[model samples]
Target: MNEQPRNPDPEIGDAFYGFVASEPQLTWHDGTPRLYFKAGQEHYEYGPDGSRTKLPTTFHDVVAFRGAAVSGDETLSKLDWFVAHGRLEPNTNPNTGVETKEFIANRLGPDAARMNIEIGTPRRRSQMESPNRRQPARQVVFEPPEQDQPEHEQPTRAM
Candidate 1:
């Protein structure tokens, strides 16, 4: 039998609206890395007949390296079979794949090259460059290269 250690409640009290996620991409909040997932539950009631349901949105703050991603996939699960994998790199670019464009939390050091998080992702302090850079159209104002015209002699006959 395995026993888990009892953790104390936060000084500010517990949260009851959003769940603390542990689904990867854990991050830090104000320089502090929160390793634990603070979960909460809410009640949901069904239509006329009889049904009670609960819909939860867990909010977690795990610590990982934070940086500007070159690109990566969104919705990592959608990108491939997770197989309950513990390591999370999201295999794809946030700008191109299954990851959301919000923020990517990856491990420090380079075994890899880049990382990206799609929009709607989670983060306490995240930053990203605009994927779509508006290129200014090249305008060619043709001035004929300012060719020196041949010197024209005035007509000798001054009639």
Candidate 2:
């Protein structure tokens, strides 16, 4: 029999609900594709009397890797609401000797239907570079995979 650990790290397996406060910057770090973004979540406090007070929005530095990073950045835009689940990582700035924290997004994405996001038509590189392009009337919808159903009935969730 396996026994669960009595005390676990509180920050592990944390979930964050917020809007992408900044554009996701994609870059190659040590030959690995990485996407970095800032997300902001509004804070609220509940008192003993059951009254809730709104507080300032707290910003989080988020990092995603490889496919998750690419898909997330491609599908999500700045100010788009998103829900992310991951572990918290703390690091120290080698140059400044200051400690910094970031959330490594294991799973992250935006809900197109809830966010009212319009999917633009695919365009060639030249067309994408041109400023006179017309907007497309396409949209994207997300459906969860039906694992319990037959293989034919399962919906693909790839973006």
Candidate 3:
């Protein structure tokens, strides 16, 4: 029997939802844009009776790179609720040798809790020809094919 070796190091990532605590600042590094901001993460405590209590919000430093940085700079404003998915990286100060963790976002976007979003179909090439082109028709109904239905209706079937 042959045994497969497992890798020792693995990548870890995290995501958090919070409100912007400060205005985003855009900077350039080696021709790449970087967006930096602070996020206020709310904390809550639940009692035995299911009562929820709000705690002091914790502030975190967040950075987005390149295209994500550009979009974040344009779309994010102070106090706006947003979500970020990324990994925590360590940054060490050259003068003090002190290290701190910063959230480096691979993806970031507005949180649905405070924003409305619509899903639309991709526009055809003709639609791109004009800046004033009318919006495409939206999908209103969905019908699954009958062939995909199981012979017997299970009470807890996965869709």
How many pairs collide in each candidate, listed in order?
28, 0, 0
TM-score of every candidate: 0.18, 0.60, 0.63
Candidate 1 Cα misplacement greater than 4 A, ranges: 1-24, 29-63, 66-140, 152-159
- How do the residues 61-125 of candidate 2 rate in per-residue lDDT, one tens digit apiece? 99999887887777777887888878789967689998889889878777544565445632223
Better of 1 and 2 by TM-score: 2
**lDDT tens per residue, model 1, 117-137:** 443543211244455768689
Tell me the lDDT of model 3 at 96. 95
CA lDDT of 35 in candidate 1? 29
Root-mean-square deviation per candidate: 21.1, 16.1, 11.2
Q: How far off is residue 87 in model 3, in Å?
A: 0.4
Candidate 2: residue 54 lDDT (0-100): 99
User: What is candidate 3's CA lDDT for residue 92?
Assistant: 84
| C-alpha-based local distance difference test score of model 1 | 0.33
Which structure is stronger by lDDT: 1 or 2?
Answer: 2
lDDT on C-alpha atoms for all candidate structures:
0.33, 0.79, 0.81
**lDDT winner:** 3
